[model samples]
Target chain A: MSIPINSSKAIFPGLITREREPVNLEFAFPTLDGRITPAEQFYVRSHFPIPEIKAEEWRLSIEGEVEHPFILTFEELKQMPARTVMATLECAGNGRSKLVPKAKGLLWEQGAVGNAEWTGVPLHLLLEKAGLKAGVIEIILEGQDEGTISEEPKAPGTIVFAHSLPLDKALQEQVLIAFEMNGEPLTAIHGYPVRAIIPGWYGMASVKWLIKITATATRFHSYWQTLEYAYWKDLYGKPTLVPVTEMQVKAEIARPALQEVVAAGSIYRVTGAAWSGEQVVEQVEISTDDGQSWQPATLLEEPVRYAWQLWEFAWNVPPTPGAYQLRARATDAAGHSQPDTHEDMRRTYMVNFVAPVEVIVK
Target chain B: MSIPINSSKAIFPGLITREREPVNLEFAFPTLDGRITPAEQFYVRSHFPIPEIKAEEWRLSIEGEVEHPFILTFEELKQMPARTVMATLECAGNGRSKLVPKAKGLLWEQGAVGNAEWTGVPLHLLLEKAGLKAGVIEIILEGQDEGTISEEPKAPGTIVFAHSLPLDKALQEQVLIAFEMNGEPLTAIHGYPVRAIIPGWYGMASVKWLIKITATATRFHSYWQTLEYAYWKDLYGKPTLVPVTEMQVKAEIARPALQEVVAAGSIYRVTGAAWSGEQVVEQVEISTDDGQSWQPATLLEEPVRYAWQLWEFAWNVPPTPGAYQLRARATDAAGHSQPDTHEDMRRTYMVNFVAPVEVIVK
Candidate 1:
């Protein structure tokens, strides 16, 4: 299926992309200024053309291990007690462009992450209404978007976008069946009728154009869980694949953009944002001399559980003019911090390295 | 005369102000995200309605103590070697709202400052081209904006906006006759065709809607110089006025916004911007224990003279939820730092005290 170029263009004007087969659009750094990005400028990563669904005709079905299987229409979902959350969403393939071994999928930069206000009905409330069973181990979410996975050509076939979440995560109050963004109805390109909003997890977990919810008695296995979004690692000289889940700590400079010229002997402000999926960002440290020395940056405010926190640093320019490498690294409450480089990764999936930006002073 | 509400509204949407007669529009903190603000969104502190001038017909005349008195058309000005500089502009009465005794003029908050990319011909180059004569003491710049200053009801009359610059300042390479903002032609609300850009000084030093520049052999004094922008100080039991020139060291928090709610047990990022007028901001420190303790914040990059440098600190939120006060203080190259309070000032103008922002942890 051909990608809808007109719809993508109208919504994302300056979106950076590497291919059009699956329609992957990366957000630029400038648009990531405020805490919440507008729906039109939000990043889009799809494995297939967006499916057209009429809101009135669409229904979300809850089945499997639930005692009382139920279906909810668009209007019924909105009628439930609405909860709003400011959550930061990041793609599992973020920072893929900086991977040394060359990742096979979309080469995404640091713009794949964005914090947005999502309003919806909590998944736990819906699950409560449906009466959950004791043996439920996982819940599977299925989206209407369907396409063929050609990464393994031998096993290529038509499949819908689906992912499974642990029972505990699915029961969290933060997880929601979102239909609104920034207090307005979601745009057509951003899952018009309904979508799953899984806070503190990779974007793939929050399936768009969601249609079905299934409670399973055992681990839900799928190609998305076992192949596409997993990270390949060397386990005791043998290869192993681990499923990507909560985001790792990472930071990026937004102002004094890459290769920007600054005045010599002048004061310049370095500002950026940092986040960790499940853990709160504890600290953000900046290095001007290539990691030789580091200083703590001011965290703008108390961080939201699933939202990125803004940070800034005051730099007094040196007397002489020259090129300087600036880098920021974030540490989370779990004691995890960004690595200096992810060059050793064989196939990039969770590339959370601290990328350096070069700036010239003259 | 009624204020031009339409023009002010178009230029400054979230401008905080007291009255509209003199049109005192302060720059809001949220808008100070990137290095440069958009032209339309830049703060407007006009004394009169925006003057409509045809760029093609406008001419900048250089007269007085120059060997070659010449007038350059708008096109001619653009043809000169264009230099783009990232500089910050701040009103002299930036923190007037925080003054305890209360200021006489407009009560401005911390949002009266913004950094921008200005492109134009260097003023020193123009001075050199005009062939400066010996013994030049000052240069007078006159704008086409005519207004009446009715601060005192007894004294009210029409006057043109004009200011004089010292010979050394006028000859500095950093000064420019800017015709563009953020790489675009100056907006009608932001001086349009041409305006003077004096770096390292308050915004009043930059005369908008430029018409003529006169080199003088002696100091030139005007109402703006001797009265309006001056600070009243008591010298030996006698009150005297001192002209406000270079900006004092000031620091303000940008994120977490004023009175914002933060999450408990979540690590919060404290971010803010700091600047010095005549000196470079050497360091920025943050205090969360109500002035009981201070910790140094990381300076992101070298400070740009006359521009605000962004600073940040990683603050681990306390486990318990409660109200906390956050304050940031900046130290300049001259060992000068922001004062804790300026309550003793008779009439507030340069209130560069360290403003405390209260945030609730919940």
Candidate 2:
């Protein structure tokens, strides 16, 4: 049996629908412990099939644009200088299903996000050993997991799996060729044995089950990574689309989901999580009357970077009957604020918008 | 064998760490389908022992300042107006260990967060059934999880595990007495059969494995909920501490952790998450150079209160040979911003200041 998550004390269990939606959500809650969302209580999002990889058979191949093309088994990779980091991983479609006009796909309700510790070797070290070649403008990656969505060769925009990074990024030390997660080897569903840790990029760019690598001056496109998942929209009424990449600033209330009831005169805790693609979250504020006024909530003791941070606030309810609209806002270290909507983006690559929740005061 | 989450293509043998460290990171690569971190790929944080909850024998009792005090089994609770919702839950200490000067306790390196669809009875239904009595200023909850940690209870401050909800919040329709998570019955580690789904509070206030409810005019205190886990600091040179309750705005790069490598001259998808505790996320900005000119990232979809919203940006790398410091920032709907340091919190609820990643270039 899968280990259980401690969620009974969860604050925002059901603010949208009464059933847990298999997607993304804006979570809010009250907290006493300074822990960010406990690992077990964190959200989850799965795409494709949850692959199961064996460590013994897992081998990392560094072949493209390198002086030495070699395949190193998991054991060999582990023997190399192992680097550890604490980071968060999010899905490109984390909150995609919640878009207005409802895009064609699963109507996910916000369960596709999570944070964890990932351990592995930096890709630069491996690349240095391989000896990067000149003119390697693009680095293409291919994974072992393949599938046929239909009987036909699906459009490159539909089924093939691949992605690329610039030679500069490929050589950067931050680009890790990882094999472990959260102080342990990667779990099957996560990229176990060997996977690329490409910080500052969307999940699409980090190819799992890596089996092949090629360096090219031109771009390498894959059905899943490039065309299908790319974000397209009308820019100033002009049809334009771009590939999904960096993250945007956003937040949600996980505790007081819509329609939650609290006894009159009782004090309740409020809390939730926040993050940005490349920025550090500066502050999180709260308001009870639909953004009428705000107060800064307490933040957890996590270092902010390219990952999620947990936050919380305590709301004192007045003994009165009324309707309350709750909202949370975030700002980053560079002075960026979350937007009310994604209307300004030429393409819907990221959706960093302010979300609100309605609660009834009986 | 423990299902390895790091393997990209398969699920098999791996080890599980009992305690997670703050700086220990494992890299994760996305699968063919664009999901880098799936449900199983996420981390788990268990505050107390995993509760041994049996759905068949489980019971949720609503007592306190109510006209009717009764205990309802899981089945009975489900018989009430059932509600379901998708929300994220985060531990307050999600990134506590990341704080500089090294705070005491678990050194989690992210991965203490998750989203889920929860289904269950609303706490309002139970409150309505009980008919809350006047003068009940707070609703205190006690979970079945019990343990005694060997630590000296400091004067005026000690950690405990009890939370209070004000009366107005108790009547909110969103408050739930949950029984299911993500369409499945509650897992044992999660509150099984019956648990409190209080949105907008930290996971601790949700009170997993709930067993009792009491009404009081004064605040209820517990070691886990108060002294031990919450934040502490000096007020004007005087030792002053603040209990962590509310959330703050925060963000981080989810995909490419620090020191990751990427090919040069290729477009990479940069993604991250952001959220606020007071208002909705208004906007997220990205900067390749730390704190340099910022560009807005794409914000995806509507978010519930207290939940982190997903965002992304696309970066077409420039052929360069220098390191790049990836940076991100966020603003809330009501015009709040994240901070640059946890020290800015003044009271030190463990909220770290925002910072940018230093990605070494080739």
| Index of the highest-TM-score prediction | 1
Off by over 4 Å in 1: A1-13, A153-156, A233-239, A343-346, B1-362
Q: Name the lDDT value of residue A296 in candidate 2.
A: 89
Which tens-of-lDDT digit does each residue in B1-362 have in candidate 2?
Answer: 21122222322222224355211222221221122233343345455566677777776667766788898776676677897865555556666655766655565544455556677777777777877787776676667754444432221122224456666765667667777777776666566656676765555567667766665554343344334444433322212223465555666565445665655676666666776653567788888866767888877646666566777777666678667778777888777777666652232243535666666555
Highest lDDT scorer? 1
lDDT (C-alpha) at residue A72 in model 1: 93
- Clash count, candidate 2: 270
| A1-362 per-residue lDDT for model 2 (tens digits) | 11122233544343232123322232223321233334333443333454567878766677756788888887888889977655556556655555775544444455445566666778778777877777777777656655444311123122325677777877766667777666666555455556776765666677776656666554443444323455533222222224566666666566666666654565656667777766778789988877779898777646557667777777776588777778888887777887766552312336556767777767
Candidate 2 ranges with C-alpha deviation above 4 Å: A1-362, B1-39, B154-160, B232-242, B344-352
Clash number by candidate, in order: 36, 270
Residue B21 deviation, candidate 1, in Å?
A: 88
Native contacts present in candidate 1, fraction: 0.00
